[model samples]
Target: MSPRSGPPLDGAIDVHAHYVTPRLRAAMVDAGHAEPDGMPAIPDWSPESALADMDSLGVATALLSVSSPGVHFGSDADARRLARDVNTEGAEIAAARPDRFGLLASLPLPDVTGALAEVEHAFDALGADGITLHTHYDGKHLGHPEHEPLLSALDERAAVVVLHPTSPPCWEAVSAGLPRPLLEFPFETTRAVASLVLSGALERHPRIRFVVPHAGAALPVLADRIAAFSLISGGPPIDVAGALRGLHYDLAGFALPRQLPALLALADPDRLLYGSDLPFTPAPVARGLAEALAADATLTAEQQRSMRRGAAEALFPRFARPGPPGAAEPRPDDRSLRGDQR
Candidate 1:
């Protein structure tokens, strides 16, 4: 199908957009991450550019986050400081245009104490919409025991946690020198989710709503395999499919033609949300993806509308009513689902 030249879906809520503050770019360069996670360079970002991209792509409001190679850069103190700075910047942006933007604050992971402190401030003081967590911090994935405290706190708040994939510690041995995003990122997401399930983090902290990006990122195909392996290994039985269905997923990054179908088989259709991994994904590419999804014939009009906006509205009530100026009214049946924090 030909991609749309104009906006594809009216008032679409983009859940996977990224924002790179100038301070964050500078910090990345200083930390020798000019090309973070083996990517060519840090993408440029600003509130104005973000808004313009949203306008072109039909995004009414974008929940912004700091993408992979998150705030941490080794030093606990420095990571904490950077996390605060970027999160504050993000909050300011969201506050300036609440109708157009929302923030998913970053954290200094691998430093549980610092992360917990920032989480408190980000939610309590900044009124952030949610939090963004990298798949792995240092050498530890999200399921690592050290992160239990942070997970518990998030669960208590029923925080919306978006998982951004980063290069695993073994990237050097496994990545074959190619950029990690090209292949390893999807694998990393799968590994981190598997760890969360196998380690009982998902079961223990059921309220922490995890939004898996890239349409569950290699997970749908591997869900049963992970579950079967857990049993075969003489480990405690893990309901991997249930864990996946309980979590939310964002349709970002090459979701159609294969990934989305696989994800739908394992995930509740209502749990699907729209995501445009902007900035990192160039505007043209992001728009193309959006247009393609909009044009996909397999999804009924209602299903498309749900993925584009309704599902997100169900998750975020703030966007359910009194939408931004000129926004279209949602269909009566669109928001049938409740905002249960599952």
Candidate 2:
């Protein structure tokens, strides 16, 4: 394929981006969770700032999701309310600029009914492109039976579910009290995926198109080991390799030459996507990561292009297309899903 006007992936879609809503950030600070999950402070974010970053980074569209320590904070009612607020605000952003933005609506997970309600409101009312979920809710991993109802609903709809990681209850304490994002988050993602595979969630929810973040977490590097563990543990006769092949993976944090090879071993061109993890990872760092990915000798020009552009285009076709008739300037208040927003 020929190159686009700007960078290598001129119109690439960044699927693993995080959005720090004003309300959520304020709440965190108020609750003395200014360092939520042990991060120094919550990152400041605005739609305008994100759009600018996307332009400079050569990203066409960013599928925004609430990052770690998600919407929930103890009370189920509080979780439901915050989730709705976040999803509504996010929908407003995407509605304002459908071409440049896509909503991966956050759910109040571990509360199946609340999650189901948000799913309906997100897809049916807000016109969200997909839903984002943490690897665990409270302390329950994705594979837990409690999550099956939500998973089943997503499966029935053939939903595009983006699985992000959160440090679960078991990991409250860490070495040197290092930030959860530094080391635990990646492994948490791996732990959740393993739970899904071994618990037969992948097999049962075959149609739920899961987009795994952090280069399939530690899965690519540890897929075989996990499979062996499963066999030795006498888990449900699972097709460990085949199960992994079905999910999509985004290259964000760990796309080094050594890491890319393992991902390539597990997935083909179409299953790869570009992710910035912006704000959390500053634009300069994102640029460096992109540069490194481009310089990786192990990946071919075609495969790199696929990870950068082709795969994302196939996933979000509207962004890949030229601006539709009468595209308007994006505003924080604008809420036009297709024609109008209620």
Candidate 3:
């Protein structure tokens, strides 16, 4: 296959991408949603706009998920409707750009029945690549009872659950002094991952694949604490770090060019994925991340290929096809399965 412009890497799949459809935008505007003050303005996104950005960034394909603060702001009925609409729209984009796009379906969380219904439609009916979820729903984390049904469904279907962080409950109440994305976003992602790891959620749903963004949040730094908590706290002592290595981590928002050691220390470079939190950060940031991953002396060429492309194939194989024979696979234990997300 021909290499994409600006990079010799083949099959670079952006595992974390957002597509804010017109339907979702209209619902948000009509509801007059009150979001965290420092929450960056939602950019206007459509399939065409997303494709152009990916092409320019040399991204061969992207697994599209809903942007943060998804339909949860609306009433239960409105939330359900918006979820269906956006999911359908996402599928349409994937159909149009078979080689360039795939969808991570959105759902109205905490509404157990609605979430289940959407899952069936998005996964069984629409054929989505996976499911996208916010770290919390109105401050209720993943371990909450309300999420059990959704988790059960994903586990049963072996779905790929892409976890995105949103400002926790009442973030707007104290948004004046803090940078929401800069600090709160990663923290929330970290908090959710830790909760899932410690609360037996990961154990309960071993088949469920989670792709954590922002360089796996602070997970690499806190691996020891999590491991200790697992042992001392009487939670599962089942190798928290190893379990984390089994999970997928995407390199988005890690643009400093100096964060390589921190990322490499947590998991092998192969576990790292290529993601552009586009429309939030510029395309250059994505390119810079690709460059940084290449320059990290700790990562070998084979490992860098996994970070840039192979891991994404593991995360969403329906969308991210593997490269030619004998190419390095992301993980030895990792297996690609046919699954869907609702």
Candidate of highest TM-score: 1
For model 1, residues 1-342, the per-residue Cα lDDT tens digits are 434667886888899999999889998999899998898999988888998898898888899999988888889999999999999988888776777788999998888999999999999999899999989887788999999999999999999998989998998999999999999999999989998999999999999989999999999999989888888777677888888899889999999898888888999877888899999999999988888888887577777777888888877767765653224664232134333221
Residue-wise C-alpha lDDT for candidate 3, range 10-82, written one tens digit per residue? 4578878887787777776666643322544657676667766776665777888877777877478878988
Task: List residue ranges in candidate 3 displaced over 4 A.
Answer: 1-10, 33-37, 173-176, 234-238, 255-258, 320-342
Q: Write the per-residue lDDT of candidate 2 for residues 1-342, one digit (tens) a residue.
A: 433333444456789898888888876677677877887778889999998888777777799999988887777898899999888898898877776788899887777899999999999998888889898887889999999899999998888889888876766566357888878888899989998999999999998888889888788889999888888776567888999988899988867866778888997757888899998888878877876676677767666666776676666665554343212233333354456432
Q: List the residue pairs that clash in candidate 3.
A: 119-342
User: How many pairs of residues in model 1 come into backbone collision?
Assistant: 0
Number of backbone clashes in candidate 3? 1
| lDDT (0 to 1) per candidate | 0.87, 0.80, 0.75
**Residue 63 lDDT in candidate 1:** 96
Which candidate ranks first by lDDT, i.e. highest?
1
If both were scored by TM-score, which would come out higher, candidate 2 or candidate 3?
2
TM for every model, in the order presented, reads 0.93, 0.90, 0.86
Q: Model 2: what TM-score?
A: 0.90
